[model samples]
Target: MTDIATKPDSIIAVERWNTFWGARDLEGMKTVAADDFIQWHATVRKNLTKDEEFDMLVEALKVMQITFKNICLTPMNNDTVLQQCVADIAIEGAGTRNDVPFAMVFHTRGQKITKCEEYMDGMSLPPIEFTPQD
Candidate 1:
């Protein structure tokens, strides 16, 4: 079995999860999530399984056309990473654009992410419409 950190799989998984704006490869996103992974969505105002949260994110992305463009990552020891991202987010139907700042802490076991805690400005960016796709 190949390890996640030193291998390509880990890198890909991290990208999919951390940069999960809308255009990220969703199929690829599955590889990094643990079977019972739990994610707390700051924007959603809920705590859900990885699968559940991912679906919500994707739906919002489709209608919103948002993306996290320039992201800076900082390694906080081997098991954790601190990230700051500036997203060029747009609401497709509304024809609006927002430059949002977000921060998250990632905890990885080997290559797979086990826990992710995200923080963002609630006042600047209101909760996005996360209704699932029909």
Candidate 2:
């Protein structure tokens, strides 16, 4: 990881976003995300609004712990960044998966993430059965 002080605000925002996820701090996630935030998942072929994404994260966190390693960040411009990392996901009752390749393009505005384009290997994910809430 590079020195936080030397990093750009866009990178800082991205780091904070990932940090919030690892810490399972939903509020922190909200703090860094713009009100109009949208995430497009290439592998899943879906677009998720901020609330929708948060809901999914909350559900996933109930059954798994995720960590990131070998992270690489590239600045696309003043407000855009590309991040690539190996996600280490450990699912309860399913064992751990290491080095699952993941990548995302983040667009930021004033320290808040406005949009994210995500890519991942769908097959690398462990299946989890999520029961619908009543």
Candidate 3:
């Protein structure tokens, strides 16, 4: 496994994270995230720690059968990166699927992400036609 911290640019860390998720490699997540990483998700309405966030994401990946496409990654500065992507979520229980567009901002210190904030349409949960099965 390549060490995430060895990368000279913060954007590389974000790219590595994308690759890990695309491959569904849970162990690779540890390399790109700081031990104390925090994630603030708009849909969740709460801040989650590194483990909590990844655990929840893993569950979502299974139940939602998520697939990502049309991703746009930008390096805003040395410490920040921005991402825009479309996520297709399968809600088999609701007998529906939704294509949602979302944006995220990643804050990095060195090559590990320290914080992440995600923005999407929602009130309490995602503002989509299908209800979350979980």
Q: Sorted by lDDT, highest first, which candidate order results?
A: 2, 3, 1
At residue 76, what lDDT does model 2 achieve?
84
TM-score for every candidate vs. truth? Answer: 0.73, 0.85, 0.78
Higher-lDDT candidate of 1 and 3: 3
Q: Which residue pairs clash within candidate 2? A: none
lDDT of 1 by residue, 1-134 (tens): 34555554334456667554344666656667777667765655556778786787677657766566567766666667777886666676555556688787777775677767777765565445664323
lDDT of 1 at 96: 53
**Residue 35 shift from truth in candidate 3, angstroms:** 0.7
Candidate 2 Cα RMSD after full superposition onto the native fold (Å):
3.0
lDDT of each: 0.65, 0.85, 0.75
Off by over 4 Å in 3: 1-8, 95-98, 123-134
Q: Which of 2 and 3 is the better model by lDDT? A: 2
Model 3 score (lDDT): 0.75
